[model samples]
Target: MRGALGVFIVRPNPDAGWSLSDADNGEVLVFESGGQAERLAMALARQAHATHGAGEVWVYDRLDRIVGRWRVAAVGMALADVDETAKAA
Candidate 1:
């Protein structure tokens, strides 16, 4: 697990159904159906050039427990930052 990972704050949206914030790049991902969250995550992973073995998207709860992981290629800067954050923490 690397890059930016946080427990997204979610709320109901009038236009959409649900909205997740504090995601990658401070963007909000809206989902119409239940599985759209995963779809949005997959798209984010693809954009981040993630494939497998190197880095992944970890969705966590408020307790910092991982709920899911989306595998992708290693992102260098992102990984380094994550490492630094981990060391600091």
Candidate 2:
């Protein structure tokens, strides 16, 4: 969250399905499944990294637990690692 050019979050919607939100832009998208939401979030993060430099994607479970994470670096590389130490602020 410190140096990210763009941050996206994927979480469950209150009503139904999953929701993907662009933390930087305040844009939201809904998907029928968590997998679909997560996939789109990663794709958007990759595009943001390619365009602006760095990006991050955070995926949360139904209980609001951080389940997955991806960080796209400025060097056009990405790391799909789930850092257990990362906490939502």
Candidate 3:
């Protein structure tokens, strides 16, 4: 919500299976389970360029259910192309 970044909401299901929502772009839907939150968060980071922004990921789990969310750094990094030197800089 602060800036442009990928978002994913994971929900568990018994019949249809886990639900993956790409709230940021809303252009894709992937069905998966087991560590779904981690997967989605990684995907979001890849798309949102988290490594560049020093972006960190947080996972929300309740009752053994995973719901992933992406958080981008407001300052520090700008989500640009990440490099070792850049990170060190």
Best model number under lDDT: 2
Q: Can you write out model 1's per-residue Cα lDDT over 1-89, one digit (the tens) per residue?
A: 22354323334466646555544357776777536665555555555554333333444344443444545544332322344433533
The digit string of per-residue lDDT tens for model 2 on 6-82 reads 78889899889999888876778899998898788878888988888777888778887777777877564365656
Model-by-model lDDT, in order? 0.47, 0.77, 0.46
The candidate scoring highest on TM-score is 2
TM-score of each: 0.42, 0.78, 0.40
Error of 3 at 39 (Å): 1.2
9: Cα error in model 2, Å: 0.4
- Reference-based TM-score, model 1: 0.42
* Residue pairs in clash, model 3: none
**Which scores better on TM-score, 1 or 3?**
1
Steric collisions counted per model: 5, 0, 0
What are the runs in model 1 whose C-alpha is more than 4 Å off? 1-18, 21-24, 50-55, 61-64, 73-89
Report the Cα lDDT for candidate 2.
0.77
Clashing pairs in 2: none
Winner of 2 and 3 under lDDT: 2
Give the Å error, residue 45, model 1: 0.5
